[model samples]
Target: MKKITDEQLNQYLEIRIKLGEENFKFINACYDEVLLLKKEEATKNIKFEITDFSKFRDFAKK
Candidate 1:
């Protein structure tokens, strides 16, 4: 199978919508899998360390 860039996902979805259900079902599954992979990479790279929880607590107290 050929790989498509994440940038082309939305464009492909738009085209898929105007197209047929059988084609849309298969392509939409691919699109969902790609979205999951992208989201995983995005969240994986984020540092979730709470370096200043006190500031958040202080603000919450106001």
Candidate 2:
């Protein structure tokens, strides 16, 4: 089994907390499915592609 990095774990935790329990589970399930594709590869790479909220702040005026 590959070792999940501490940074990835922390990011996951932050995402979970921000999303709350209900949404957290749903997001986690999606991630799990993606991870399944790289089973036991000894190097797990979890990258989060989140857009900055400030980028959309201008849209609020519309």
Candidate 3:
């Protein structure tokens, strides 16, 4: 992930500090929950590649 600019960092800190610790905690929790849900939603079509392993095992190596 790219680092935020100093200006953005200053803005974010100002907003969160103004919101206060208690409110900031709630915001953080909600943000995390939403991010997880959004990630799950985004991967709805994800595919897994299945492979049989017996042929690639140690016994087959020789």
> Which one wins on TM-score?
3
- Give the higher-TM-score candidate: 1 or 3: 3
The TM-score that candidate 2 achieves is: 0.45
Model 1 stretches with alpha carbons more than 4 Å out: 1-14, 17-19, 45-62
The superposed Cα distance between candidate 3 and the true structure at residue 1, in angstroms, equals: 0.8
Over 1-62, each residue of candidate 1 has an lDDT whose tens digit, in order, gives 79898879988777877887898888879999999999999889666558678877899999
User: What ordering of candidates by TM-score runs from best to worst?
Assistant: 3, 2, 1
lDDT tens digits, residue span 1-62, model 2: 79999999999888878899999788879889778856646345633345645555768767
lDDT of every model, 2 decimals: 0.84, 0.76, 0.88
How many clashes show up in model 1? 0
Which pairs of residues collide in candidate 1? none
- For TM-score, candidate 1 versus 2, the one ahead is 2
Worst-scoring 10-residue span by lDDT in model 2: 40-49
lDDT of 3 by residue, 1-62 (tens): 89999999999999898999999999999999999999999988975445545645756888
Give TM per candidate: 0.43, 0.45, 0.69
Q: Which stretches of candidate 3 lie over 4 Å from their true place?
A: 47-62
